[model samples]
Target: MNSFWAVFKRELKSYFTTPLAYVFLVIFLFFSGYLTFKEGFYEARQADLKPFFVNLPLLFVFMVPSTAMRLWAEERKVGSVELLFTLPITIVQAVLAKFFAAWLFLGIALALTFPLVVTVCYLGNPDIGLIVTGYLGAFLMAGGFLAIGCFFSALSKNQVIAFVLSVVACAVLVFAGMPTTLNYVSTFLPPGMVAAVEGMSFQVHFDSMQRGILQFQDLAYFVLLIAGWVAACAIVLDERKAS
Candidate 1:
């Protein structure tokens, strides 16, 4: 626990000490708002953040990876991974601490968009329950993406390679949940297989939560997905240590 906190504090502080955190926040906030108002038709739509929520998964495809690309990549790049291993903490603890730090930073960035909630409430009566659920889904989805990013970051010594690989990997998951992707798959695959693929989509689970329907299965999918990737990260670290 002590070692976890130590790494958490160091990694979280590292985000702010450099320009990365600020740049990411600014870019995210700007694009989120732009997409919501311009593409989302915020003025024309009813008192709902549906458009914002709709765009979030796509935004996360790029943004979360950018934030996570440095987790272990930078450590290896500068040879600080050796120092990290020298600590009393186990590899799993370090992995969780770093993952949580990045995840929490994403939470902070998401929370900063609260003014959107405020604006929607001020405009008219909105389903507060639905809005809250949407944010919850977004946060969970971000964690899932971050976990994938962390896995790839641990695998690569170059940050750019980590970012690119994370983006590609996350993009597949994101697109898999889309109706278009599923439709394309259905043309080639049988109905049963198509349904299975659709069920595996991050967007499918996220869309359910976005609608204020918090199914246990949807929640479990994100939890298990994150756990799986984090475990993979630990394995990669172990292999590197062995090598």
Candidate 2:
């Protein structure tokens, strides 16, 4: 537990010490706001933040990977992964610490968009429950994306390769459940297969939470997704250490 906090603090501090955190915050805030208004936030004449929540999955597909690409790839690239493994911390502990640190960084980034919430509140009355659930869903979705990125980052020494692989994987998860994608697949595929693909997607569950419906299965999906990838990341790093 002590080792976990030590590494977690070290990892979290590294973000602010570098330009990556600042640049990510700026770009993320700019693009998130731009995409929101561009989608007719005002023109829709609605007080809700639907435009913002609707665009998050697509934005996270690219942004979260960029944040995660350096997690293990940079360590491997500089041969510091060996040094990292030499620490007293176990592989699982190290993995969880780093994952939670990055997850918190993302939470901070997500929290910085509070002005959007304030704006919505100022505009008119909105469903507080829906807004709260939407943020919760977005945060969970970001964790899913980050976990995949962490696995790919551990799998590659090259950051670009990790980033590209993460982006592709995240995109598949997000796009697989889209209405158009499902419709197209169902044209030839059996209904069970199509349903299975849709169930495996990030969109179907996220959409439910975005609409303020937080089912146990939706929560379970994210918990399982995050745990599965983080476990994979630990396994990869453990093997590398063994070798």
Candidate 3:
């Protein structure tokens, strides 16, 4: 527990010390506001945040990866991963600590968007339940993206490589919903298997949350996605230790 907290603190501080936090905040705030207005707030004749939530996964593809690209890659680049091993902590502890720090950073960015929620409230009698659930969906979706980023970050010593890999992984997750990808997946599969393949996408799961319906299965999908990536990261890093 102590070791986890120590790694968490160190990782959190590292985020603030770089250009990542500032750049992402600027991009996220600008794009979100731009989309909110462009989508026509009160004039759109709808209280739904369809415009806002639609572009969410797109924003996360870049921003979330940017935050996580350096978590472990930077350490490996500087030959400091050995120093981490020299500590009295296990690889899982380090992975969780860094993972949690990245997750918290994503949460903070999402929280900072509260004014958008307030604006929606003031504009109309929007469903607060929907807004709350949408935010939850966004947060969980971001976690899934970040976990994939963390995996790529641990797999390489080059931060740029990690960034590109994270982007690709996240892109595939989002793009699984595209007609081409879905068709391809369904080609050789049975009805139930096709359904299951399409269901593996983050888009399907997140859309359910954005609509204010919190299904246990959607929530489980997110939890399992994050857990799978984090577990893969730990396993790969463990191999790095042996090597």
Model 1 clash tally?
0
Question: What order do candidates take by lDDT, descending?
Answer: 2, 1, 3
Best by TM-score: 2
Worst 10 residues of 1 by lDDT: 37-46
- Which pairs clash (backbone N, Cα, C closer than 3 Å) in model 1? none
The residue-by-residue lDDT of candidate 3 on 51-107, one tens digit each, is 788888898998899888888888887878899989999999999999999899889
- Score residue 163 of candidate 1 by CA lDDT: 96
lDDT of 2 by residue, 135-229 (tens): 99999999999999999999988899999999999999999999999999999999999999999999999999999999999999999999999
Q: List all candidate RMSDs to the true structure.
A: 1.2, 1.1, 1.9
lDDT of 1 by residue, 1-243 (tens): 599999999999999999999999999999999888876455565888898999999999999999999999888888888888997989999999999999999999999999888888888888999999999999999999999999999898889999999999999988987989998999999999988888888999999999999999999999999999999999997787433
User: Lowest summed-lDDT stretch of 10 residues in model 3?
Assistant: 39-48
Candidate 1 overall lDDT versus native: 0.92
| Count of clashing residue pairs in every prediction | 0, 0, 0
TM-score of each candidate structure, all chains considered together: 0.97, 0.98, 0.93
Q: In candidate 2, residue 80 scores what lDDT?
A: 75
